[model samples]
Target: MTPRARLGRLLNDALHRVMAEDDSVFVLGGDVADPQGGTFKITAGLAKAYPSRVFGTPVGGAAVLGVANGLALTGEKAIVEIPSGGSVAQSFDQILTMSSRLVSMYGRTLPIHLVVRCLVGSGQGDGAAHGRSPQRHFLGVPDLHLFELSPVHDPGEQLAAAIGLGRPSVFFEPRSLYGRYPLTPRAEPGVEVTGPFGGSRWMRLVVGAGAGGPSGVAAEVTVFCTGGTVARSVRAARALAATGVTVQLFVPSRLFPFDLEPVTGFVGPGSLVSVVDDGPGPAGWAGAVAAALATRLWGTLRKAPVLLASAASVVPAARELEDRVVISSTDIVRRLVRELETP
Candidate 1:
C-alpha cells in the first residue's frame, strides 16, 4: 500500500483508540469538517463519527491552541490540527508562554495530550507561508514533544502511533506524503509501544567498502540524512560506489535529541562525515550533529566534520525554483564524490 493509505489508517486507529480509552480526548481544528476533511483529508469522517468530540474552531491559531490548553488543563486530551507551520507561528505565544510553561509555573501536574498536525515541505505551491518548516522554533520548548513522520509505507500505523502516544507532540506530516497511498487498518493499538523520544533509528548505510579493506577500497566518507532526503542519499551512494569510493549512508528516523552515538561510531579516525537535510542550513539538525560529534570525539578525530544543508532561505514558490533549492539525489552524489576525492 502507499504511504497515504497508511496515514489514513493510522489516523482512524488513533481516533478510535483515543475515544475508546479517554472521553477527554477531543480533536479541534479550523474548517476540518467532512467532505473537505481539512486540507489532507486525515480528519475525514472523524467529525461525523464523533460529533461532540471532533469539531471545527475559529481561524485564529492562538484561539485554537488556547482552547486546547483549556481542555487539557481541565482533564481533556485535545488534538489541534493546524494547517501549516505558518499557521503555527500565530500560536507560538500561547504554546511557548502558557501551554508549555504552565507545568512549572502553577506546580500543576498536567499531562496534556496535545497534537498539532501541520503540513511541511514543498511541491504544493502553497506559497511561502504554507511551505515553510517552522519546527526549529519549537525545538527546545519545554512541555512539548516534537515528532516528525517520513514513511516510505504504512502511514496509518505511524499516524495511529502518534495520536495514541498521548503527549504534547507536534506531529509533522510531510505534505508530499499525503495521497501517496491508501489507508490500512492497524492490527494493534498505535501507541502500545513508545520508542525513545528525540531519538533516531538507523535506516541504512551507503559506502564503497562492504567488509574487507586493503583489498577492499578504503572507507573514506560517511553521509547522514533523513526525511525525503534519504532516498536521494541512497541514489548518491550508488553513484559513489560506481567510482570505487566507500560511502556510508545513515538515515535516522527520529530528528530531535537525535541519537548521535550510532552516527559517531560510524566515523572513525581521519574519516570525513557529512550531514544533509531538507530543512534550511544555519541552526538545524546538521549543525546539532556536527556540534555533538566535535564535542564527543574532538581529540580522537583526524579531520573536521562537514555539514551540508539547504541554503538558509525560505522554500521558493515556483516548482523549478524549489527543486533547485531542495537537495537532490544528484547533488548528494556530487558532494560525496568531491569530498571523498579531496585531500
Candidate 2:
C-alpha cells in the first residue's frame, strides 16, 4: 500500500532531501527555522540539522528574495519561502526584475539554482488580509518556470521536479490542502500528470473507457485545472459523468512555458472546454488559458471556452461565506452541466 502523508510533510522531506543531496542547496525564509517552523511547519527540521544552511530572516520578503537570488547566482542553491500571498506581491520587483531576468539578460544563464516556494490560496478563514489567491500574479512574470503542487499530487515529487529545472522556479503550494492528505487511495488520478510540471506538453487519457474503452464513449467536456482545486475538480468531473456529461481533466502542473499543443488538439472550437482555477477571474490564469484556447480552437468551437473561478470580489472570511465566494466541487458540476446541456 502507498504510504499516506500530509502534503506539508512531503514538502519538508523534499527540501531536506535536496539540501542533503547537494551541498550547495539550502533554505531561506522569514522565521522559517524558528520553533514554529514558519506559518505551515513545512520547514520544521532543517534548521536543527543544517543550521549553517537553513536561514531565518526578518519579515521582509523582498530583501530575502534578493539575497536568495544573489546566492543562487554565486553557485549556491537557495529555497526562499514566501510567508504569505501578499508577501509575494511585496517581492515582485526582486522576482521579476532580477530573478526572472537573469537568464534573459544575456539570452543565457549560469544555472542560478533558486527554488522559490510560495504558499497561496484561500479558505483558512484567515480573513481578507490573508485571503488572497495570487497564483495568477506569478503567471504574468516571464522567464521563470512556474509550478503548483495540486492536492492529489505529491509535494516531494513536484518540488523535486521544480528544483530539477536548474533555473529560477516558483512553486505555489495552495495552503488549503497543506495538511489535507487522505490515508488511503480514493481513486486513480483521471489524467496523466507530469512536469513541475507536467513534463510532456500533453498526453491523452481515456477517462470513460475511451471512445470504446468501457463506457464506450468519448468525454464530452475537457476540464483544465491546477493546485488545491485538482481533487475537487476530479470529483466534480466524475460526478458529472453520472449525469451523462462525460468529462476529461487536462491538468498541467506547470503554467509558464506552457505548451498549448495538447490543449489545441483535444479542445477544438465548439468543444466544451472549462478552465477552472482558484485564482481571480479577470485577467487571471484561467483567463489566460481560456484566451489561448479560444484562439487556438477558433471558428470551430460551439462557443467561447468557459472560465470557472472564485468570486471576482475579495475572499470572504467565514468558511461558509468563502465557499459561496470560491468555486467549489459542486460549483463545477453546476457550471459544466449548464454548458453541456446547452444545445
Query: Please, what are the lDDT tens digits per residue for candidate 2 over residues 1-343?
Result: 1237777777778788888888887789887895868778989888887889988988887899989988987878889898777678878889888998875676665676787888888878866667777877777676688887765456676677777676788888788777766222244544333222135233233344333332345567877777667777877866876666656666665767677774555553356888887866867778898898888887877677899988887887888888888888999989888887787
TM-score of each: 0.81, 0.88
User: What is each predicted model's overall lDDT from 0 to 1?
Assistant: 0.65, 0.73
- Give each model's clash number: 17, 11
Error of 2 at 304 (Å): 1.6
lDDT of 1 by residue, 44-100 (tens): 787777788987877998989899888877767777888886788888888888777
lDDT of 1: 0.65
Give the residue spans of candidate 2 off by over 4 A.
Answer: 1-3, 106-108, 182-216, 267-270
Cα error, residue 112 of model 2, in Å, equals: 1.6
- Quote the RMSD, in angstroms, for model 2: 3.1
